[model samples]
Target: MTIDFTQQALQVLQIEATAISQLARFVNDDFNKACQLIMDSPGRVIVSGMGKSGHIANKIAATFASTGTPAFFVHPGEASHGDLGMITKDDVVIAISNSGETGEVLTIIPVLKRIGAHLIGMSGNPASTLARLSDVHVCVQVEQEACPLGLAPTASTTATLAMGDAMAVALLNARGFSADDFALSHPGGSLGRRLLLRLEDVMHTGNTIPMVPTTATIKTALLEMSAKGLGMTTVVDKHGVLQGIFTDGDLRRILDQRYDIHDTLITAVMVRNCITAQPQMLAAEALKLMEQRKINGLVIVDQHQHPVGAMNMHDLLKAGVL
Candidate 1:
């Protein structure tokens, strides 16, 4: 017998996609009740299952933990040993079993009941043992498994995982979880840097700021821009108050006018309405402002409008804010 690999793969994908689509009906009142139980609990959420369900349970726990819900996974076999000690009555436990009668998962049901932990069960069978024992049962009943023999997990696990995500997202919305909150749970990489980094953290400070006095020549401003390498220079008054900004772009535009850079005041050609940002503004927000203004650099200012710091697109790239 010859096998068609692409057709087989397509069939599996179609079944799983259908499994996900059928999940909306399961997101009914019982789902909200389960979310309420988790929200009202004083302790964390515990997720547990056997085999393939265990893999999905682990990811679900991670999603909950990353999204401001305190959660972790415990293998049902491990829970039977001594890991059950990790769970408390205040915690809510979400148990998974496709058949709803897995021996290892079932073995811990009475213990969970005795401990008074709120139980949310996920099972493909509504009439199964785990579902019957749960405080709230979420049915992940799929029409069929994607497996050719209907023995492997396939579509059932996909539906169960989808339901878990729906639960986590609903709870995330209910709790008003924000990007800042997510950054706290994940502070290791570009994701954290993007969310947590502020303009103050990356801007060049004090002497590095490109500046030329209002009385200075455009030639002086160009020299300062070269020394600072920001492609721009701030034209300020003797009082150290910002007056305007001159950029290499300004130089290009005024080239045909034949004005002598050697003698012309920078304030005469500088952008008087240049945009500025606060030192405390988010680097991400600064990036947006730069794009919107179609400018390359920004002067960070204090409340008194004195330049406190400066940054450009290259600085953002080096800081990984890009």
Candidate 2:
């Protein structure tokens, strides 16, 4: 007996897709009420489940926690052993079980109620004991399981996960959660770095900035660019105001024109009114400007139009903004 793996995989996908689509109907008043309960709670949301449900519960708890709702997962088995103490009157408990008859989860309900905690149940059976006992029940029922044997948690788990995501996102929008707020919770990740890093934080400042007076020769500008290793130098006037910019590209063009690099003034060949950026601008935004303008470097200027700092594509790459 040979199994056509491709056909079986397609069947599983079709079954799960249908299950997710069917879940849209169940996102009615009960789902809104569940979101309200979680939003109003001053304490954390405690999520618990058994077996495969337990794994999904953990992920759901993490999503809630990261999206502005304080939450954590507690295993049903552990809750029975003593972790039930983690629940308090100020918290909301979300219990998960496909059949809604998981022995360990059901056993801890009476104690949770006694502790004045609110119970929210997610189950496939609305008539199950867990759902009946909950303050609010979320139905995660599916027409069938993706498992060919009609066993195992497949489509059911996918629907349950989607339902949890919907709840978390609803609450997140209700609270007006922003990307910056999300970044705070994920400070160690790439998103945090992209949102938090500023141009000033990574730009070469002080003596490291490649700059030359307008009176300086192109040769002097090249020396500054070489010493600073930024491939560019800002040309300032006598009053220290930004006059123009000279780069290696400009040098190549100047050489093609046969300009006297040894004696020609930088002001004669530098690109005047060059693109500049503020120190406070985000590095990611600066990278966008660079790509849009087809430039590799930017001169950081203050309000007085004086060059204060300098940075290039290499600097942004080193700062993880590339």
Top TM-score: which candidate number?
A: 1
Q: List the candidates' TM-scores in order.
A: 0.97, 0.93
- lDDT tens digits by residue: candidate 1, 1-322: 9877998899999999999999888889889899999999999999999999999999999999999899999999999999999999999999999999999999998999899899999998999999899999999999999998999999999998899998899889999999999998888999998888999999998899998899999888888999999888888888888888888788899999989989888878999968999988989889989999899989988887788888899999998989
Highest-lDDT candidate: 2
Each model's lDDT: 0.92, 0.94
List clashing residue pairs in candidate 2: none
Candidate 2 minimal-lDDT segment of 10 residues: 187-196
Q: Model 1 — which ten-residue stretch has the worst lDDT?
A: 235-244
lDDT at residue 148 of model 1 (Cα atoms): 88
Taking the tens digit of each residue's C-alpha lDDT, what string does model 2 give over 1-74?
Answer: 98779988999999999999999999999998999999999999999999999999999999999999999999
What value does the lDDT take at residue 180 in candidate 2? 78
Candidate 1: residue 212 Cα off by (Å) = 1.2
